[model samples]
Every structure is written in C-alpha cells, then in structure tokens.
Target: MAGTPSNEPNEAPSSGADSAISNEKNRILVSDLMGDEREVFLLFNGSEYRLRVTNNNKLILTK
Candidate 1:
C-alpha cells in the first residue's frame, strides 16, 4: 500500500449545511471562553457568525 488509512474511519463527508461550514482550522485565543470543554469552531458561508461545539456536543453562536 502506498498510503496509510485515516485514524478516523468513521468520519463522514460534510452535508449541504455542513459544506457551508469553513473547513479551515482557526486557532483562537479565547481567554474568556476557555474553561473546561472541547470546542469545534467554524465560520459559516457569507456570515460573520462563529460556531462553537463543546465536548458534550453543545452548539454555540457568536458574532
């Protein structure tokens, strides 16, 4: 084999709504928001809003 498999075999393709989410990883220094949760941040298409997912899969929106 010329390549190795992905560690995340369960990873699925993005949907139409998910496609609108920015694929880019953003490193944000959130001294205000950081506490004790895992976060998934995304930028939506044509919107300045930001998405934040927690370790518990909770959703958060910020401008």
Candidate 2:
C-alpha cells in the first residue's frame, strides 16, 4: 500500500534560522546547481527536467 504524504505546508528558512539546524546534505548553492552553465539537466523517476538561471538572475524549472 502507498503511504500518505505529509500535508504540512513548505516554508523557507527564516532570516534568523540556524544553518546547522537545517538539512545540510540536501543543500546546494545556485552556482553549484548550475555548474558553470546557465542550464542544467535534472533526472527524476526516469524523466528529464531542465533547470535554468534566467538572464534576469531568476530560476526556472521545466519539464
């Protein structure tokens, strides 16, 4: 049987939040995420997704 996912709302870390208290293993810098390129490919569940840093310095993820 499939398990029910949590219904809690996702929230961003507060300005005063402690980094140590958060999950560091899953954290990555934007530069690292882009990896010397404006666009990067992300693979999830056998599907491909594109992550891009827009010219305006915004992020966009597309399938």
Candidate 3:
C-alpha cells in the first residue's frame, strides 16, 4: 500500500513533463498570463475553462 499509486482524482503524477512543471510551487504573476486583459481561457483534458478577474479583483473560473 505504501508504494501503490493513488487513485485520488486530485493526485498529480510525480513524473515526466507534468512533473517537471508541477514539482515545485511555481510562482506566476497574473499580469504575465492576463496582461492587458480581464480574462483568459484555460484548456485542460480537452475542455475549455475561462478565468476572469473582476473589477473588485476577484478571480472566477467557469467551464
């Protein structure tokens, strides 16, 4: 059990390209991703999601 891989939906694999990008707590500025824009789209597992920054500076994500 100790060495068994997790079946948890939230568990991220610890290898390969995803691992390289996910191993650390990478810090990315919102300005870098959403420069001059209030919203951006994210593609994950073939689905699209929208991320928006509200006037009050709150973030919202919708599918």
Each prediction's Cα lDDT score? Answer: 0.58, 0.81, 0.86
Residue 25 alpha-carbon offset, candidate 3, angstroms: 5.5
Candidate 1: residue 30 Cα off by (Å)? 23
Looking at candidate 3, what is the lDDT of residue 3? Answer: 75
On TM-score, who's better, 2 or 3?
A: 2
Model 2: per-residue Cα lDDT over 14-33, one tens digit each: 65557555757668998877
> What TM-score would candidate 1 get against the native?
0.25
Go through the candidates in order and give the C-alpha RMSD of each one to the true structure. Answer: 11.3, 8.7, 6.7
> Which segments of model 2 are wrong by more than 4 Å?
1-22
- lDDT for model 1: 0.58
Off by over 4 Å in 1: 1-47
State model 3's lDDT: 0.86
Q: Rank all candidate structures by their lDDT, best first, as comma-separated numbers.
A: 3, 2, 1
Candidate with best lDDT: 3
Error of 3 at 29 (Å): 0.6
